[model samples]
Target: MRSISVKIVIKTFLLVLVFGIFSKIYGQTDLAVKQKSNFWKQVQFGGGFGLNIGTGFTDVTLAPNAIYNLNQYLALGAGLQGSIVSQKDYYSSAIYGVNTIVLINPVEEVQLSIELEQVRVNNTFRNPTTGIVKDNFWNTGLFVGGGYRMENVTMGMRYNLLFNKDKNVYADAMMPFIRVYF
Candidate 1:
């Protein structure tokens, strides 16, 4: 009975000591965070428009976005992106999902990023005179891209290989984007 009581007392002391140490650590962390909060509010809103000219086609696209800093090291934003795609035998419309951006700055005015977004495409392939509709379709693809920032603007490109095996037999696409970030 005495041994049991002594063991309980020792355990209680150790637990109290551990809690005290953790509390001190947490207090220091809180102080550091409060000191750095101002630097994070320097976020701004910006985006860009670019023309895509590729193999046998041309597209006009616009993407507008905003960024909010979560901390001194990370920022997040979303935007609208769309394009009018033209082909030799078809006309298609494409839209971008809420393009989510994660900004990680390694140096002043320079950032590396990982982005997740969806691309949507709708097209019509039919003879104008024959009145026979050959194809009408829509699709969505997931993609990842990265960018480099210079001053108040950024430039980047990404690739998306769609996997709509049923309607999109040969519907794989790759896009390069350039944007100005304020």
Candidate 2:
């Protein structure tokens, strides 16, 4: 009962946001040119990185991306993703991937996104009695989400449309993120 109502509220909130943003976008009355005249002026580059090292575990991530703003409302971009993670005497993995993204900013403070990603995962697990086991596979995901935006940064949550419990690296299909692009 409560959970169902929460979901409905969330959906309604998103609809309201989209409607407000669209109205603001089309309501512009300024005579100013809406797009940049120089191609180079529309390009931006940025990425995300993470490093975590503790007692017996280590995880490092690097993802670099570039986007070309088609105009005030649209952007198309691509990025590379890489990660090295290890747990002592347990497992170690190398992940590499590429992704393409489309971002739409109907209003300066709200952005919607769709991204397609393919990652190759190589993992090795150690067992005292079984020697070692190696697992390698490719995982692809299509993510659709939105975020609150401020300048070149956005904070949001995205859900993977093709998540499998046994075949996924993440524990859940939903992931929270803070994205920054210059």
- Highest TM-score: which candidate? 2
Error of 2 at 99 (Å): 0.5
Query: Who wins the lDDT comparison?
Result: 2
Residue pairs with backbone overlap in model 1 = none
Model 1 agreement with the true structure over 22-68: per-residue lDDT tens digits: 99999999988987775555667777776879887887877788888
> lDDT of each structure?
0.67, 0.91
Candidate 2 has an lDDT of 0.91
With a 3 Å backbone cut-off (N, CA, C), the pairs that clash in candidate 2 are none
Q: Which stretches of candidate 2 lie over 4 Å from their true place?
A: 1-37
How far off is residue 148 in model 1, in Å?
3.4
Candidate 1, residue 28: how far the Cα is off, in Å = 28
